[model samples]
Target: MPTHLWQKSSYSAEANACLYVSTPDDATIRLRESDQPDTILTTTPTTLHALIRSAKAGQLDHLSTA
Candidate 1:
């Protein structure tokens, strides 16, 4: 089996769901649920930054509720 290597978030709870992120040398950031690190989704830095900004602006909550 392949290794499920991922970095843990500082705010992660022991029994609750969390996320893990891996930034590769090629500048791609990969993300996955901490409980399922083997399955990953990759995104560019610019896209990730935009998503973070949108999240901070509360735009994501509207999208999530839609």
Candidate 2:
């Protein structure tokens, strides 16, 4: 397994608890929460792209209580 060089989202709040993303290779995307470093999720680039697009378009706002 390649090392997951995670980077925090620029849109993340100025707190430590935020979402992180990593692409160890061209075909793989990894996501994890800063507070739960060990619990990482693997996804495809297409899926990740869709997720980001949806989030930016507020398509997932209903999932959040805030």
Candidate 2 lDDT, tens digit per residue, 1-66?
A: 657678998978988889999988899988898889889999999998899899999999999986
What is the C-alpha local distance difference test score of candidate 2? 0.88
Please, what is the whole-model Cα lDDT of each candidate in the order they appear? 0.78, 0.88
**Which 10 consecutive residues of model 1 have the lowest summed lDDT?**
1-10
- Expressed as tens digits, the lDDT of each residue in 1-66 for candidate 1 is 444457867777777578787776567888888677667888999998998999999887867745
Q: What's each prediction's clash count?
A: 0, 0
Task: Give each model a TM-score.
Answer: 0.73, 0.73
- RMSD in angstroms between candidate 2 and the native structure over all alpha carbons: 2.0
Per-residue lDDT of 26 in model 1: 61
Cα misplacement distance, residue 24 of candidate 1 (Å): 1.8
Q: Compute the lDDT for candidate 1.
A: 0.78
